[model samples]
Target: MATATLISTISTNLRQPTATFQPKTPLLFRRRQVVAFESKPWESQEKVLRENAFVCAASRRNSNSSSSITVTDVSVSELDDKLRKVLQFVLWAAEGVYIIWLFLLPYAPGDPVWAISSDTINSLIGLSLNFFFLLPLANSVGIHLLDAPVLHPMSEGLFNFVIGWTFMFAPLLFTDRKRDRYKGSLDVLWGFQMFLTNTFLIPYMAIRLNKPDTKYTPRKDSQLGSVMVNGASVVGVIGGAACLISILWGLFGRSDSDFGSVADRWEFVVSYLGSERLAYAFIWDICLYIVFQPWLIGENLENVEKGKVNIVKYLRFVPVFGLVAYLLCLDVDEEV
Candidate 1:
């Protein structure tokens, strides 16, 4: 009777609807791929656990690993540290480029360019370009701010131009990695480059985008001299305000209906042998080079080495004098 009942039950299960499928547990239905794990009975599982522990420890050393690792071997989170280092590097690159292009290059007298441009584009281009900048590239060709020759001796204007943009471009390589900040900066750069390429759009965009409480506020809480930087901004603001006041005092509130008056006053103050601005800019460049540049570069170099990504040690081989030449005309003078 028992055998007959068991057979009947088996037949019933087999005859059940063909479409019905049984649910599978992981261990029951998993496809078994053949992998050779050779070890003494009872030892293979132990070996795997030991190997896994070693792997967990080794992964902790990765620079990109999280700072927040745990015994369960969660990867270390370096989000903050890596980002800070990257931001510093971006700033260094921007500042270094600025010093070379704006400050040093411009220091050379403008007579060469002035003579070159004198006829066609010079007279008008200088007035247009020298709106705020002191370097009257146009004036060198033949333009006057107010019956006075409007030229910044080349170097003074170049320095300001480069330094100003250095701050603007610094954040590009910086990965606050904060998506919102990153997106905001990308927008600003796009806008800036657009304006640079087309000067006529400036007034239109200014009106369209510049609502004091609404559109004009800086996109992100930034690090450069913004209130975002604690001590630095405070110091910079006070000094910057003072300089701005002095500049306006010399520049505006005039009835002469002059065109390049603002540009002329700036050149008078920053030109070499004219004001201390050249020396001052050079000094700041040196401070940045010696104190900040090396450390930032070093951090990146180390990261490359540790990552096993090959790098030329050309930076190490570079002479310290290269940096020194930045603040003073060391290279130019020494060669001369």
Candidate 2:
């Protein structure tokens, strides 16, 4: 009975629940699991910082290079501007000196050479044509033909014409449109003066050198203007043709006692003026015409509509300067 009670007591002791404590999972571990489940993809902080630094360095290098180039270009441009101004000033001074010399030549001691030179220049200038031609006429009349009256008008006319033409035409050569009323009026005034004098052309050319290229617009012609242009052209052609025929007749056909042939008239002209003076005058006429004619054609062409293969423009290069022919054949745009 004791053994049985002892076994029962041991069994009861084993079967009875023991008072034992079990530890719970850590709070930090649970939080980490939740974060891992919810987290998005992200770059490493160190890698991001390195990439930003590289970009900043590249930008700095590019900025430094660009700034250096800009500084160099500015300095070069300033130098060129200064050089151009100096060149222009020198040219202007030279031209002024020449003009003054030409004015003073008449008062200078009259050597035979100088007198002959002056007479020759006067003959080609057209100012003294009446004077020279009138000399023979004056011989027929009672008056004696003198060099003073002839030379004075010739020199004065040439100088005045140069100045007037230059100033009047400069603005026209450079600008396509005149938006300013004051400037437009000034241009008109200059143009009017050119018709009278033609000497202001020198200053006009100087002014043009400093001007920028302007955008050109073609001008439309009106009915009356077109009619006038055509009429003028036709008249010019007829007059030119007559003039040419007259010259050819004088050169070849004329058998007058005085001024019989082209050669005879040329000899008379040379004898009347002087070889040195005539030569200089001829040279100046040729040079001035050569220099101015191209610009004149260009100015006229600017207002005309362009098309493929303009034969008339090409014909400008023909001998005898082709100026008369050009004027006769091609109608200039009259809108401007």
Candidate 3:
């Protein structure tokens, strides 16, 4: 009976549905288990971490390169500044030495003509009278003097003419109009006096040095006509004409027979070099032409207009003809 009952129970179990024997877990949980078995979150995290490390390394390299470049640039800038300062000091020292040599040249050994010639003295007196009295007296009556000759002894005329024109040309090289003062009238006057004496230029230079920071409206800020009509042009024209006339007369005209014949002028120049006054004068003139003029030209270059080429700045380094070239190429309208 027991065996028969057992067989009947098995038959009853086999006849029941298979679903009745399933687990208690939900269908959604089983689907998630299958997905978790296929995908790996930890492996994906490891891959992302590796990519991040690589990016950080590249960024570090770029930063290091930029830092190195910055350091190199700073070093180069510092070196350039030092070199510029050294050059400026050398120039100043050279100018000082030249001035000292001029002062001492008069005291050098050997007999030198220190006293002014009687002929020069007489010429000066005549010049003073003509400028102070005759010219003014003639102008009051609407009668203009064609020319007033001040320099005596054709050699003196040549000296004054050369020096005066140099002075007139100098202010044009100044970058700052205010530093030049009075529309460069003072510079013109000082330059004009350079023909008579270099002593005047010393004071002018002293004043300029002491007030190097003086400020004024830049030429670029004002109307072009303002600068053009400020009398500088008129003065320049007159002074240029006078200088040309004096140069011609000194080279060829026979005004003073006392200085010897025109052919002997070269000999007179040689002898004049031996004189203390003329030696000092000549030295000062050289200093102005070589040292000061070039310096001023460099300053003027700082104010050049954008996109404009200033060839005169480089040309100013050439002797004699350089200044002439600069004047010819000067564009007043383009100056700062």
- Top lDDT model: 3
**TM-scores of the models, in the order given:** 0.24, 0.42, 0.50
Q: Candidate 3 — which residues are off by over 4 angstroms?
A: 1-66, 104-154, 173-243, 255-259, 298-321, 324-329
lDDT tens digits by residue: candidate 2, 6-44: 999887755542312124656444433333343334554
lDDT order, best first, reads 3, 2, 1
State the TM-score for model 1.
0.24
Task: Between candidates 2 and 3, name the one with more favorable lDDT.
Answer: 3
Worst 10-residue lDDT window, candidate 1: 327-336
User: Which scores higher on TM-score, 1 or 3?
Assistant: 3
Against the true structure, what is every candidate's RMSD? 20.8, 19.4, 17.0
Root mean square deviation (Cα) for candidate 2: 19.4
Which residue pairs clash within candidate 1?
Answer: 65-76, 66-76, 66-77, 66-78, 67-76, 67-77, 102-158, 106-155, 107-155, 126-138
Each model's lDDT comes to 0.36, 0.43, 0.51
